[model samples]
Target: MTHDTGLVITGLAKRYGDAAVFQAVDLNVAPGEFVAIVGESGVGKSSLLNCMAALDTWSEGRITHDGVDLGQLTEAQAAHWRREHLGFVFQAFHVLPHLDVAQNVALPLLLLNRPDPARVAQMLDAVGLQGLGERLPSQLSGGQLQRVAIARALVHKPRLILADEPTGNLDPRTAAQVMDVLVAQARQHGSSMVLVTHSEAAAARADRVLHLTAQGLQEPPQQAVSAPNP
Candidate 1:
């Protein structure tokens, strides 16, 4: 398939030894669109996201972002590509313990050799951590820490955002709040997002939702509706 300004995955598959994790997966995410993938556990949902990010290898298929084919990139090139164009939010809220909130959010910019404290502050405010940038991760609650992850993911204005069960660790109320911030920031930045989750509520917010299976992605079958008595 031809690459446009967003992410494309064509006939993708992953395997370990002789066992297939998933196969025949195809997806296209338009710029500024939010797509969510839902599947049962061990169906390789996280693995698919990793492949898109170039953090893992696929047994077959092509993944391209904005015309750059991921399979062709060397290790260093992939790292550079991720730094420049990808933002990742993890379920665990992977903020560094040694660094304060602002420092954690500033890492992507620092890696690219472009430090923008103002941008960092803006992201903090956007995620509702306006004045808590000086607090350590240990000092914050789980919900607050997740906000820090969201800020860090968007601080560098990545072209694509890949989140792996980002709300899995939060309570229902906090999960809703976190999704609100994440969706708003991703929209504001015009970043195409692909989120893999088991949460029906989370998937409901996406522009489209697909279920992943070994055979490929397809829309979930609709639930039956009963006729009411007249």
Candidate 2:
């Protein structure tokens, strides 16, 4: 539970055989800071996030969080580490079909054996899903489902949050709201966030915006469209 230092990724590279997806990537995201990485589709943006979460391995370099090297962790150790220190929001809404909103959001807490009904309620309220917790995922719209995912991700007070196109299926207004909720919750809990988005508006909400290419990560040449006022 090292919270003093932030995520440090140095010379990170990922490849398959001789074909390189991305290489020579160097970046640092301070604790509690939010960073957005934007790139063309198929540039391995999602792969980068996966590598950071220890769900995927890298070919070279190191990824350290609070001085803990992710590459050194065994699969079981990585799973345990992720549960305790990471939160992830996926584009597909990954909510279970049979579980109610509250139950879905409560899974993380349950896994950690730290069930807190009040905390679940607080997260639902934070994501504007307060009274709808009893509803199943099938009963919710795309926007509502995404909110449920957001709530679930933030409920455990994780140190690092990785969001991959959370609002890709959302309308502009809903997307804006989702972004607000995500950013607000991350700041409130002092968690570092790394967002991979193709949406310029979403990318603009981050503290810094970087472009990902076959060569590596770098500042974008063109300015991103800032998030519209909600």
Candidate 3:
């Protein structure tokens, strides 16, 4: 699968009745770019990500990916588009309870009708779940389940990756490890990634970090990287 990878959002806005979630948001994610969005809780960060993935409707704006306007696609077409070009990792580890780790990671390839056992194993190893492919979600800890999610999300090499608070449920060490894997995988595949997170360590790894506010996306004060603890 091939696509002209890039994302462009113009005049993006979301509203309900008299309340506006966010508005006048213009952002561009170039191919291979990893952009992180940071904001306070309930600032519509996840909502914005949903709109970017075409999973939710926006009140006004244009969200174009690889020259295709998402708003122009029908629901069925949008689902197809998502299957073909997008991968998502959410705060909740949405792993299938019935399927084992390997099968869960293989789901995207199955959807694309291109099953490859080798790819599944490779992703398992990539996310540090090598020998546990046969284990069910019930057998894994919270951090391990999240690793499976990361592996699954990047297994298909989707042109665009959307991660919403992917490490929200993990300890700081696990979160750092997951962030390392995520950034590494996206860069390796030249995929653009939009990560919404409250973790400073995770956001620090992004190519660009933008703060979300009621007004729009803005550049926050530059944060100095804290040296690693001995």
Candidate 4:
């Protein structure tokens, strides 16, 4: 299988007035690759992914998807680009309580002005939510609710998938299961994924791991997980 060779970031940097987040960072993600990003609090992991996803603007550097520059797009163009090529899974489920399971998942398709009931149901079932079509967001557990979010993201079959703290709110077992679901499905769709997570176990699920720091995303020369000191 051929992958698009993931996003490339060069001279990537960001700042918030007097505070600096990332600088001179470079990254690459091939299609079907799952990348995990981790760092200390306030280290700008989410900020970095946000910029790459075109949700936040950066001070310099360029982010490209299939060779299309993201920083150069107009607002309308950016919106259209995202609708066509990107899918996002947030830590918080972000489900609309007023809408049932199917509606929430169908939102992207709905916004695109195309709705296919069979396709939507297939996505829901893919996430193990077959008959919950009528269930409200409040009726599900943390994991189940997140599955809804996953279904929603994948329903569009976007080229890039950005997940921020996706499992931060779940217990360890639930988080693991959810991560498996995400990883497996993303691979099946051949989507490049950038996951921002603090859990080492979650990071382990990725093919590569990077730390967001003052110097941008840094690939640690030594990669391993160690048990806590006695």
Q: Against the true structure, whose lDDT is highest?
A: 2
Better of 1 and 2 by lDDT: 2
User: Worst lDDT window (10 residues) for model 2?
Assistant: 221-230
- The prediction achieving the highest TM-score against the true structure is 2
lDDT computed for candidate 4: 0.86
Q: Rate residue 147 of model 1 by lDDT.
A: 95
Q: What lDDT does model 2 reach?
A: 0.92
Best to worst by TM-score, what's the order? 2, 3, 1, 4
Where in model 4 is the C-alpha error above 4 Å?
1-5, 221-230
Clashes of 4: 2
| Tens-digit per-residue lDDT, 92-172, candidate 3 | 989999999999999999999999999999999999899999999999999999999988888888899999999999998
- Per-residue lDDT tens digits for candidate 4, residues 15-122, read 779677878778888888899888888888888888988889998888888888889899898898888778999998899999999999999998888897888999
lDDT of 1 by residue, 1-230 (tens): 43447999999999999999999999999999999998889999999999999999999999999999999999999999999999999999999999999999999999999999999999999989999999999999999999999999888999999999999999988998999999999999889999998888888889988989888888875531112222
lDDT (Cα, 0-100) at 57 in candidate 1:
96
Q: TM-score for all predictions? A: 0.95, 0.97, 0.95, 0.93
lDDT of every predicted structure (CA atoms):
0.91, 0.92, 0.91, 0.86
Clashes of 2: 0
Which of candidates 1 and 2 is the stronger one according to TM-score?
2
